[model samples]
Target: MFIELDFQDNGKQSNYQAISTLAQLGYDGVVFSRTINDVITKNDICTFKELDLKELDQNENSSFKNLSSLTLMKNEKKQFRQYSRLNIIISSKKNIFLLKKMENILKTYDIVAVFPQSTEIFEKCIDLPTIDIISFDLSLKYLIKIKYKQVNKAIINGLFFEIRYSSMFKTKQSQARKNTFSNAINVVKYTKGKNLLIASGANDPINLRGPYDVMNMATFFNIPFNQAKNILTANSESVISHGVMRKTYFGVIKVEDKKKIPKELEESTDEDEDEDKNKEEIEIEKEEMMIEKN
Candidate 1:
């Protein structure tokens, strides 16, 4: 089983800590947060702002060129295809040149770009066969307005009681909340060509629940167990491997002799049998001696 954590909303830990936690959790990879802050400071992309329906460009002086060169050099410092596949989040109104530059960086690591649910932005940029992890955390009533139905996977980010309990239980109105989940599930099930994924939207590792815990939430909302597991496990794996190159990774080899018997108790049956045989022989010899004496 594999889990893909969406860490776009979390900021409590340093970048290294978050990455290390994913490694510890046995998560295949992470969907990293890429807001306006990281790219500008890291010199990944040219900055942009929107005004009156046009995207105004920024100055690309020698400093910008030098920074870009430095970033590329730093990128070259890493081994080719060294890391596992990871996801990067980007919004709709980002600069096109900057977006392309980001794509190049991600391509080195074989990262998947998860775009927002904007038709215009998707059409302009999502040209590569990169995976689309659709966001469905919007209200059930508003989610129906989204135009794209051909996403790679769908994420029910904040569906659990820990996140939605206030809206669900505040006024003792269970039916509406139940209907909302049912509607969302039906949309996911009936969507023409999209896969379903569920996430906790957890800011911390403690908020991440086990498989059975997620199943209980699904059961309470009348969702099937298999469906829940798919969202929680299978779909996440699909998203992680979507854009990455495949490799055959053979693990570390044991230096011990293969033909030797194992030291475990289950493998020690031969010694036990030998001891029993010796006891039986001794008893028979004693009986014969007793008969001779008689």
Candidate 2:
């Protein structure tokens, strides 16, 4: 299923509208991201709490008209899932400490992404398993060069690189657009298209694009058509899967699987048991022969 993993709530549009647009464009899921600063601010917290209370009260209303239209859309033939993520923009060592303190709360979200503002922060983030995506500010290219070693290490550690297409359209300046394109190409080059994810990062419905349209746009960065397609589909799915795994116990135990084990896997398990049994028997026979000789 096609997914867009970064939709910012910028007050220009309601999440319901943005999600409706995404569903219409054939997206199966959209992750709504809120920056750490916004989430931590007192005013924002109060506002969000008020809104939450209002929504809860509305839900209690018996009238069907008071129900969220998004619920109806979800029940439709094409199902759309909405997920929430917390994006931490790490700039200072102090911010890292703050994140450590808030890490437990952050883990409550479906995904937690880190946007490192400096090379030092980026290096530290490469080793952080809690952070799913290393999101760069794709609006402009920074002076710091990202080394291939760091990107490769992150890939080995199961961290994904995120490129937001919405940043390119946010600006009218040609130079900003150039910088965005250049930074994206540099990231794609360093990562070698492995563990690379392309997302809308859209703040409004107008900025969102269809899955195929996003694939076409990705090719502009010299990415192969097949790889670009995977960025939207397979790679994005992997990111979500990793996010889901992160919140589980040791990133291994998902909800207990109810389905029967595959025949091939069951057969392999049986074969492994038989091999162990035969090795034990052979050792026992060798010991017996040695005792007789003695």
Candidate 3:
């Protein structure tokens, strides 16, 4: 499923009206991004559940069920596959190590993202394993310089770099647009379009576009054609998986009695082994194909 990871909030609640529009534009899900301060005064977790929304189920267990009271349309609520994301603001150098202290707090949200305002903050945030995504204020006229070494290190550690196309296309500032293009080009240069997530960070419905349209526009940032599709598909899915795994426990817990195996253990299957093997082969094949094509 194609997921839009960034949508600015209206007041304290998510704008479901705008999110419903995304469903018509070919988006399977939309992530509501909330901004939090440096200090953790409140450990509020995301109310929306993190169930896989590939097949639409509008029941109580539905991922978007939490938004029922926010909007009156019963049919529109299930049309959205929603997840709550927390964007931690890192302004000063001292805030770099804040993740270490907020490990428990971080577990509450479905996804945790950090936006570094300065080079020092960016350098530190890239190495943080607790966070799923690393992004910058690309819409700014003066953007942060992206280094290959840092970008490579982040990718190696299984973190995604976000590209918000919604803001870039809607902004009237020429310098902001130029900076977005230049910064994105430098990012695609280092990572070569791998481990990058393309999202529509739109505040309004007017800023949203179809998934393929966003993928097609990504080439303007110098992303390879094949990899651009993965940015919206595989790469975005990786971020979602990393986010859900942040606080979830998939392993079995040992008990005193050997005969009494927990239901979790009994239900476990090795079906994922072949799937993992296939994924590795597919990824390597894509890399080889892109290398040969280039």
Candidate 4:
């Protein structure tokens, strides 16, 4: 499974320490969600094939030139090539100039997806190639509204939810599980497009869930197990593999602390896993009952 780290655009924790931790946690790629403002040190930026959209401006030709310049400057030493993939998220106002700029950006980078938050912008860019709407947490009702409004023309390729905030908001993990299941079901019912991506708005490694756990969550939602696996692994891998970001570590998981899995998640699975376990218990009970009756 291909795991990707959710790094805030502002580069809040964009450091080698942070990247190293994600690499250790089994993230294959890193998606820069917003405009990363801070200048990361050379060592940190070299960690993986990371992405940024700050250069996506309205000037079509200038945008490509600008991307090339940034790539040249940031990866002159080919530090980014060591990682598996590089990607970009494009979203902006729907002005003609901005549209031109977006076209230019698309020409230069292998855009992983276009994240449109505003209705106006989404309308203008929904038909563009390789675009996906970022589904906010448990906002299935909200997405349903959006799908109806867009007449199913919105070319969303995946769904994403914030694990960090949602987990905290629910306080209990079980509640979070229910919310996740409901959200997925809603999106599946409303979505016209086909890919469903599971992501943690992980500013750091702590936010990521293990591949097995993510799959288990999908199983709980009754989402096809393989499809759920794709959300975290294969889908992200495809994005990174074809994206423009240079690979830094390539295949190696950047090991920092040699950390082990936490005891709680290790011992106990989530709601879906528990349900399967319950099914087994019931089957065993039925067999015992048959034996007694006989």
Top model number, lDDT: 2
Candidate 2: clashing residue pairs, number: 0
Compared with the true structure, all predictions reach lDDT values of 0.40, 0.70, 0.69, 0.42
TM-score, ranked from best to worst? 2, 3, 4, 1
TM-score of each model, in listed order: 0.44, 0.71, 0.71, 0.48
Which residues of candidate 4, in runs, are more than 4 Å off? Answer: 9-14, 35-97, 106-121, 130-141, 148-181, 241-294
Task: Give the per-residue lDDT of model 3 (tens digit) for 111-146.
Answer: 888888888678768656678988777777676876
In Å, residue 5's CA in model 1 sits off its true spot by 2.5
Better of 3 and 4 by lDDT: 3
Specify the poorest-scoring 10-residue window by lDDT in model 2: 44-53
What number of clashing residue pairs does each candidate have, in the order they appear? 0, 0, 0, 16
State candidate 2's TM-score. 0.71
lDDT of 1: 0.40
- Mind giving the per-residue lDDT tens digits that candidate 4 earns over 221-291? 56677776666766665545434321222233333232443343234334764575466556656865897
List clashing residue pairs in candidate 3.
Answer: none
lDDT of 4 at 35: 30
